[model samples]
Target: MKNLTDMMKQARELQSKLAAAQEELEKLEIEGSSGGGLVRVTLTGKGAMTAVKIDPSLFNPDEAEILEDLITAAHNDAKTKAETVVGEKMKSLTGGLPLPPGLNLG
Candidate 1:
């Protein structure tokens, strides 16, 4: 009974920490770039896109496809970084507890 009580208390604390971590993630930002830095993307830790930048040289009517590809690559890079950040935060918050695989938090 004592062990159960202690475990419940820890669960409550972990839940609180998880909520705070999620809120903090929303406020954090990460940047990723591709195509030799000609394209850049910024995303919040929660995987929301905040901004995108492209070099003026890449803005050519004949290179629309190239531009589109670069933008997609940059966005993917930023999203990957955001996922890594969130994963690290969650790991810390959970004290490295092993969660079931494929259970995405977001």
Candidate 2:
């Protein structure tokens, strides 16, 4: 019974830590750029895009498709960075323990 009680206490502590970590992750801003910095995207640690910036030099209507591609690339870069940050945070919170399959904090 004592061991069970101790385990329960540890579980609650872990839950509290996880909650705090998630809150921190939600406040993170990650930036990624591509095409020689002609395109840039910012994403939250939860992988939601917050902003995008494009160089004015790529404003030609004829190059709209190219601009779109650069934007996509920049978004992908930002998403990858956001995922990385979430992963590192989760890893530290879990003390490097592997999370269950299909379970992701990001």
Candidate 3:
């Protein structure tokens, strides 16, 4: 049927776009900070951590736990941002089409 053919064509185009978007995401970088900017994390759009920074003052051995907590928080922030970026890109590629709940492209 013509409708089926058209749908297939659209799906193919969407797949292509999604592949390109994923590649772009791999190249993109996002930064997240916590602890009043004492700790920072950089992650690729795909949620891979590329780098982490911590203030020298936080290097105290006794305060290692606090540093660890800040790092985790910073990482989580970056990951959330990465997911948001992917979601926005997907929404744009889909032209605001409603996807099923929990239908993650990642």
Candidate 4:
């Protein structure tokens, strides 16, 4: 019974820490650039895009497709960075414990 009680306490503490971590993750901003810095994207740690910037020289109508591709690349880069941040935070919070399959904090 004592062991069970202690386990429950630990579980609650972990839960609290995870919640706090999630909140912190939401507040984190990550930036990624592509096309030799001609395009950039910013994303929250939760992977939501917050902003995008593109070089004005890419605004030619004929190069719209290229611009679109660059934007996509930048967004992908930002998303990857955001995922990395969340993953590192979760790993620290869990003390390197592996999360269950299909479970992700990001």
Top TM-score model: 4
lDDT string, candidate 3, 1-106, tens digits: 9999999999999999989988999899999989999999999988889999999989899999999999999999999998998889989999999888987775
Expressed as tens digits, the lDDT of each residue in 1-106 for candidate 4 is: 9999999999999999999998998899999999999999999899888899999999999999999999999999888988888888999999999999998787
- In the predicted model 2, the residue pairs found to clash are none
Reference-based lDDT, each prediction: 0.90, 0.90, 0.92, 0.92
Of the pair 2 and 3, which is ahead by TM-score? Answer: 2
**Segments of candidate 3 deviating more than 4 angstroms:** none
Q: Write the residue-wise lDDT of candidate 2 on 1-106 in tens digits.
A: 9999999999899889999988887889999898999999998888888899999999999999999999999999998988888888889888898989998667
Distance from true location, Cα of 100 in model 4, Å: 0.9
Alpha-carbon runs more than 4 Å astray in model 2: none
* Model 3 worst lDDT window (10 residues): 97-106
State model 2's lDDT: 0.90
TM-score of each: 0.92, 0.94, 0.90, 0.96
Task: List clashing residue pairs in candidate 4.
Answer: none
lDDT of 1 by residue, 36-93 (tens): 9999999999888999999999989999999999989999999998998898988887
